[model samples]
Target chain A: MSERLTPHAPLTPAVLAILLSLAEDEKHGYAIMKDAVKPEFGGITLGPGTLYGTIDRLLRDRMIEETGTTDNERRRYYRLTSQGLKTVSAEIARLNAAVAQGRALGLIQPKGAR
Target chain B: MSERLTPHAPLTPAVLAILLSLAEDEKHGYAIMKDAVKPEFGGITLGPGTLYGTIDRLLRDRMIEETGTTDNERRRYYRLTSQGLKTVSAEIARLNAAVAQGRALGLIQPKGAR
Candidate 1:
């Protein structure tokens, strides 16, 4: 059998979006779903199943951890761990490099360089 | 049953890297594999099975099309279709937005903003 891929090796879009949502502050599942689908953030309308599934994977990888519940008691908030912070930072850097390469190849224009 | 997701709706990192590699010029599988594994591109070392599997899906989705073979005859080159071009462009825009959000939230620093 082929070796299984790492949990976050490729950082799927949904997972990245979820990580970005929690990057600033702790948030519940619904809050994350809302933040992720904002038009400015690519309008990714992740269904509840997909959102929680990604969250479960992220949690298992130790990239994110659940803190305490909010006043609602049922709402569990999540935040990025130290490892999660480092992973997200590295992912951003890699993405930045990809964008730079895209610009260099002229497939994409530099921001405000139009 | 939940609706099946679009092939490119949430472009995976490996697929995005493959599309980026073909954005500039048509390349055979090995050439794409090489470009994608560069450290700057996130060091995504895709196995042969994984590579071909992605290629087949992309082809089935009409995101990429196989052109005539190179001089080696066994080597088949692939290029982005018009739809593929549009898809990649949109994916990049989404990623840019994510990066911008990451910066605004102080989760990540801007390029050379140190």
Candidate 2:
């Protein structure tokens, strides 16, 4: 087992999506789920089980923290910690690299190719 | 629950890595592992168990199939099926979309940005 001081790469879809969502801004659970459905986020629809389960893991991992604001008693907002930002940035870099590789291999068509 | 056909998106790292590697060319197990170590493939290192297990699943899912090349009797080669190509292509597109979103949100630095 490799031991480095950050969340592992190849993050689960749920985790990656949630973190990316939070990276944009703090949001409640429902807002994260809504953002996930947009095409840019892979059109992912997170069921409650996956959404909350991943949230729990992120919290435990210290990648995310809940805001203490009391304005909304029913909704708890969450945001990315510094560690969360680092992890998501790393993950995106990995994806960007893979995309470049795909283009070089001709596996993916050039942009605007029909 | 998504009812759309094709393997679900947000592929596990192992599965995506193996498919992307094979997308380049047919290879035996060891070759796949070798490619996984490269930086562009997310630097994923699949354990033997995970490697074989995911291979089994991919075969069962018809995304990949044994190439039946007996030139090297000890090694079994594998390649992407049409389905596999479609799957990997879609996955890359999803990643591309996410990267674009990351940029728009300023979550990821613009290329060449310091």
lDDT of 1 by residue, A2-112 (tens): 544334676777887788788878999999999889744546988999999989988988889999767697799999998788777777777767766666666666778
Colliding residue pairs in candidate 1:
none
Mark the regions of model 1 whose C-alpha exceeds 4 Å error after superposition: A1-7, A39-42, B1-7, B40-42
How does residue B44 of candidate 1 score in lDDT? Answer: 87
The 10-residue segment with the lowest total lDDT in model 1 chain B = B1-10
Look at candidate 2 and tell me the lDDT of residue B15. Answer: 89
Name the docking class for model 2: medium
What TM-score fits each model? 0.87, 0.92
Q: Best-fitting candidate, measured by DockQ?
A: 2
